[model samples]
Target chain A: MKLNIALLPGDGIGPDVVVQAVKSLQAVADAFGHTFHFEEALVGAIAIDKTGDPLPEETLAVCKKSDAVLFGAIGDPKYDNDPKAKVRPEQGLLKLRKSLGLFTNIRPIKAYPTLIEKSPLKKDIISGTDFTIYRELTGGIYFGEKKISEDGTIASDLCEYSEAEIERIAHLAFKATRSRKNKLTLVDKANVLETSRLWRRVVTTIGKSYPDVELDFLFVDNAAMQIILNPSQFDVILTENMFGDIISDEGSVIGGSIGLLASASVGSDIAMFEPIHGSYPQAKGKDIANPVASILSAAMLLEHFNLKEEAETIQYAVEKSLEKGVVTPDLDKNSTYGTNKVGDFIADFILHAE
Target chain B: MKLNIALLPGDGIGPDVVVQAVKSLQAVADAFGHTFHFEEALVGAIAIDKTGDPLPEETLAVCKKSDAVLFGAIGDPKYDNDPKAKVRPEQGLLKLRKSLGLFTNIRPIKAYPTLIEKSPLKKDIISGTDFTIYRELTGGIYFGEKKISEDGTIASDLCEYSEAEIERIAHLAFKATRSRKNKLTLVDKANVLETSRLWRRVVTTIGKSYPDVELDFLFVDNAAMQIILNPSQFDVILTENMFGDIISDEGSVIGGSIGLLASASVGSDIAMFEPIHGSYPQAKGKDIANPVASILSAAMLLEHFNLKEEAETIQYAVEKSLEKGVVTPDLDKNSTYGTNKVGDFIADFILHAE
Candidate 1:
């Protein structure tokens, strides 16, 4: 099989992590007897510095031509601190998602046994926790019509949802649920908001088609508490854009290191994989940042194309690395490996996997 | 001093816990040499059972006539399970908030040392966590306009925040911040939502008035993650209505048990205090429900009245109860004390404090 992948090493530690993910991808390709081609593109703060645009026209063209995009990270301290700045690095990623119609973000939170003790949560409470959050990316109040009065006293945002919007994501969640634990929990404030009520109605009707998947509802407030109290109780969580943003980020803490979580944003035709962590400007040139999240993102990119064995190989290598304590300082302060060494170890493990 | 308080024990363990709060309030009144007058009103499922309305007109009248309202939990399995039911207990609380114009909901989360081991989080991580969430109530999408398409296919809720609304809550949070840690964190999704941008503009301007209080900002998504990762970092959290609802509930876990969390809703003139826990139908009439949250609500009520010494006395007595192992089973699995016994112990302690 031949695959075309786009690499967007945005800014800061983005370049370091992307290099590691590319090496791991190459290793996966070698072990699986597959051919993979990569194209590099400029985005985010680096793009702004080079071309005066966070996402250049050529960068978007390269992404459109690729079968998949592996993103590293986006952000810069310069842009982050200046609230008055009209243009920033994060805009590039948001625009790319909108341009490519990447409307659904999938984040899987799992408590690895080897790292469970590292979690802020007690081992007994977090051991069995594993769930994925399917967050609607492009709709809801976040993108709704916003208005401010002439005097700047009143501001309003309209949170609108159509049957089509809810159905598109509901199908993904319900189908995924059928394959996993056969349970789908929709998190919304249905008791209050019209959009949430619509979510319930649409998801409930859609669930009838997938009889094997059990469907349930939880208010967002209760869902937030439950994520901390009993994360294992959830299998697949479906929520609107804003609720999804909050809940999925909250889920990121379940595994202890935000640096270790990878996310995938996909739509009907396009998919993008990236580490959820931000680009640490302080660690940009140090080569000490963790590369596991980047490597796992490569795995998610493979799984997006039905390459389950290849994906599992990458996952296994990561687990083995953690078990052997071959990690960066973020996970183990005493470990001697830097970002590149950790990447090298994982690639070597992946290539040797049976 | 003379005080007129309204007591609304909605359903299930609501009555049980409210009884304990009343007892504690009486103890505070005696210690502070104050005359307290109590009036009772019906709301929630119980009110629906007798009056066919959740928040009856007379009930609102009673709350209006009071200096403050002390509320217990509200909800029953009968209403929760039946989604198609037109009348529900939560509607009563929502209506009561709207009727009384209670626009600010304040929830304080403290990691009590005696109960640190009971938390799902590692003790070291949560031991020093203490913060309050000032949630803008009676606005945002919850009370926004709702519309459903004639074809039952589309729905939308408008999330509007006036500068007046933002300023009202921001002032409260900023003022409180000065008296506390002199640090205020405004949580919003400014990059995405128009309402959030308005919030930032209004709050930033308001921050100028309180030069002693340091102000910072956090996106709702990052705020949720930070709550779990480093809750101790927050001093006072101010947020819009819906974000507040989700974040505040998420904050409840920092302290361990939802049964020990209490909240206060205050507007320009009226304030209502209630436990953050729901009415547990299973524990009704069993005398096993935890009453600490309700007792703490009474403590918050005293604090709201500028009776700082009286509030601290109640807080001190409650701490003494936890130290003496006088809590119900929720805090201690080996404990034999019932809800009433625990309430009596705290009240007894409060009345005898030097």
Candidate 2:
């Protein structure tokens, strides 16, 4: 099979980590007898510096024409601390999602057995905690109508959702549930927000069609508590954009490090895979930021294309790297291995794996 | 001073808990040289059964005329499970909050030295985790314009915030920081929600007035993570209604149990105190529910009225009760004390204290 991949190594440690993802992807392509072509594009602060547009149209074009886009990370401290700046790095990523029709963000929070002890939570609470969050990416308040009054005294964001919008993501989540534990928990604020009520109504209606999947609803507040109290109770969590954003990050803490999680933004035809971690601006040139998340994102990209064997090989390599302690300083601060070394180790593991 | 306190012992464990709070309040009044008048009112499922209105006019009148209100738990399994039921118990609580103009909800999360071991998080993470959350009670999506399209295909809740709305609570939170460590973290979804941007602007503008207090803004998602990752970093958390609801519940996990936390919803004149825990309908008739939260709430009420020594006495009594293993089954299943017994023990401790 031939795949066209657009590579967006946005800013800071993005370039460093994307290098590892590409290396791992190359190993997968070589081992699986597949042809994978890559095209490079700029986004975020880098794009803004070069082209004066955070999301250059040329970058969007490359993503549109590709089979899958492999994203590194976005954001820079300069853009982050400067609230007065009109153009920001995050806007580029949000725009990319909107432009590419990547509406469903799947963040799988699976705690690795080797790293369970690293979690701040008790081993019993953190162990066997595996769940995926299906976050509705395009709709809700993220893209809602934003207004600032002339006097700047009032600001409002409209949280709107169409029935169709809720239905599309709910269907994907339910399907994922059938393939896993067949349990779906829809997290929403149905008691207060009409959008949440709409989400609950649509998801419940769609749930009837998938009888094998058990469905439960929780108010967002209770859901947040339950995530920390009993994470094992969830299998597939479905929520709107804003709730999903908060819940997914909370889920990241369960894994011990946000640097270890990978995400996939999927639409009907195209999907984009990336690490859940942000660009570590301080570690940009230090060669010490973790690249495992980016490499694992490449694994997710392969799985997205139904290349199960290739994806498993990449995951096995990551596990082997962990077992051998060939990790970046983020995982083991005393370790001598740097970002490139970790990437090289992972790529080598994939190549030599059975 | 003479004070009329409206007591609403709503449902399940409500009566048991309120009894203890009233007893503690009476003790405080006796010790502090104040006259306390108590009035009881029905609410939640019990109110629906008797008056067919959760916040009956009579109940509202009693609350309005009172100097302050002491609220017990609301909601029952019977009403909670029947989502289709029109007159639910939550409505009463929501209506009460709106009617009383209880717009600022103050919830303090602190780990007791005796109960720190109960936390799922590591001791290091939970050790210095003392912070207060100020939740805006009456605005944002909770009271926004909710609409369902005539065809039932679309639903939306407008998340609107005026400058005055955010300014009122932001100022209060800033004042709180002045008394604490003088650091405030404003949690919002400014990157996505227009309301959040408005919130950031208003809070940032207000922050300038309190130059001694260091103010920072965090996305709600990141705030949720940081709450568990490094809870001590926050002094006072200021947020809108819905975000506050979720984050504060998440905050409970760090303290070990929701039953161990208390909250105060304050208006200009009227204030309501309640335990953050929901009514455990299963433990309704059983004597297992913990009364520490209610007892502690009464302590807070004392502090509110400038009865600092009396408040400290209640707190000391609660700590002694926990230290001596005189707690409800929820706190220690191995212990033999019941709810009423625990309350009796604490009250006894307070009265006998030298």
TM-score for the A-chain in each candidate structure: 0.98, 0.95
User: The CA-based lDDT of model 2 is what?
Assistant: 0.88
Shift of residue B115 alpha carbon in model 2, Å: 1.1
> What's the C-alpha lDDT at position A293 in model 1?
90
Which parts of model 1 have CA positions greater than 4 angstroms off?
Answer: A82-86, B78-86
DockQ of 2: 0.82
Per-residue lDDT of model 2, residues A1-354, tens digit only: 899999999998999999999999998888878899999999999998899889999999999999999998999888789979889988899889878889999999987888877887877888889899999988888778888789877777778999999998999999988767999999998867888888888888899999999999998889988888888889999999989988998989977967879999998878999998888898897898899999989998998888988998999999888888899887877899999999999998888874
TM-score of candidate 2's A chain against the true A chain: 0.95
TM-score of candidate 2 chain B vs. the reference: 0.95
Q: Kindly report the docking quality category of candidate 1.
A: high
Top TM-score prediction, candidate number: 1
User: Could you tell me which residue pairs clash in candidate 1?
Assistant: A153-B163
Tens-place lDDT per residue, model 1, B304-344, is: 98898888888898899989899899888899999999999
- Give the fraction of reference interface contacts each candidate recovers: 0.92, 0.90
lDDT of 1 by residue, A230-336 (tens): 88999999999989989998899978877889999999876999999989989996979999898999998998898988999999999999999999999989989
Q: Give the DockQ (2 decimals) of all models.
A: 0.86, 0.82
